[model samples]
Target: MKKTAYQKELAIKATQKREGTDNNKRDVMKIQSWLTLFSMRNPDSGTATGIDGDFGPATERAVKNFQSFNSLTKTGIVDQELFDKLSSNLKEAFEKPLVGNNLRSLMIEVAENHLKQHPFELEIQGQSNSGPWVRSYMDGHDGSPWFWCMGFAQTILDQASSAIDKNFKALMPLTYSCDTVGNTGLEKGLLSRYQKIRRDPSLLKQGDIFLIQKSRLDWTHTGVIIAVEGDVIETVEGNTNHQGSRNGVAVMKRTRSLRRSKIDVFSIEPLV
Candidate 1:
């Protein structure tokens, strides 16, 4: 992130200070933003430091964890060395190339992480019906109690791809409907579905999006294909529960066989 004029002025002062020093609030906030970004892109970076620009214990913990990951001393200080490494890592991720299974792997990585944030739900007003997690997939639309399986899938794809600076919408259309994925994938020549009455499940790979037709007009349910077994496939699905209904409760990892008659697979480009 390019620093603002004020932030640049503060940065000069903050650079000379250590953990115990009382740095400028804006400087600390800038560091907080970097800390949050670092954790957002790394799967094992522990809890993200909020970008509130406050130098709190949470920020220190995040700094320590980041330093530990980069093999730097865990002084919990936002020094020049730590800032340099953070800048370098962010640059690398921004410049990271999305090729072959990289996108798929990143999608799977995101799915696995969200799986741990289970019991995720919706709220009416200030309750569970709406929140940041719910709003994420809704694409800034109010996250009411609408069916959100496709929203979940598309949101994760967008976030995971952007983490490495890939254009997820360019790779796959971002829509709240599963049919969009199928249509876009087919139009882009990235979709694969065997013409036979019963297609082989082995043809599906991790990171493929599965669409289950709910009616003649649209495919209603969706999930991310995590792995393909001999006859069945593993999945991480949203708006689903133990029974795997379209209007299910939360995200869950499921194992089920291919219902070729009722399913279509959308494989990302260069993956099929």
Candidate 2:
């Protein structure tokens, strides 16, 4: 997709906003945001250090305390797992439309929230004696009976819709098979499906589905489109790796510059 001049300018501005912030300021805001969301998810966990947006001594102490309690590395830096957990809680809280905030920021927040809530075991394939390459986040449960990337993608969409009280039934579902040899293999059938959706713009909206083909020519990843700025589509995806780790969502420009097998789009409709 070709980016318009205005879109390019917006992208540049977005990048600059992120990069212009001082590292300390950025980390402080991030930590505060994480703590706020965490508190929402686990009220029993106690109140957050507050959204001071400054990584001062108090914030550092609080992070260390959290890490110690969670039995995570007490380095005081918010790692991926901690970040994801916090994000999940925040997403549940802000599941509705945010009235006064930047859309890009909200999209990032929603993506992080969805990633934190999505369990990793759900990405694994069929019955196996041992777990898949990824660690299971679900407590006391063995690996899931089966794994479906499309279902995982749908879960994000459902959660996003619920947060905003929006009717997501308008978007249609794109089914995929877990079996490696089946017609649903990521590259074979998934790519074709995405192409079909992209070719038809009328079907797509703010939160549609897009399947990106990773290595091995299969539809190895799935994401929900949060915002479309000209040619670039901001997305949230799951199961890009064998590890059940929620690859924190990203906002990459839709350009040929990035190397990938193919991109599939699915226009979902509201359920009648």
TM-score of decoy 1: 0.57
Which 10 consecutive positions of candidate 2 have the poorest summed lDDT? 1-10
lDDT of 1 by residue, 15-122 (tens): 523445667765675566556545656869863655554577888888888888878788888776667565453223223343434777887877777675452444
Poorly placed runs, candidate 1 (over 4 Å): 1-101, 125-129, 143-145, 194-197, 215-217
Q: How far is candidate 1 from the true structure (C-alpha RMSD, Å)?
A: 8.8
Sum up the clashes in candidate 1: 6
TM-scores, each model vs. reference: 0.57, 0.37
In TM-score terms, which candidate is top?
Answer: 1
lDDT of 2 by residue, 162-272 (tens): 445544334433333322322333333322344444555343444455655543345455556666654456565544443322232221222221123255554433321
lDDT of 2: 0.41
Model 1 poorest 10 in a row by lDDT:
1-10
Best by lDDT: 1
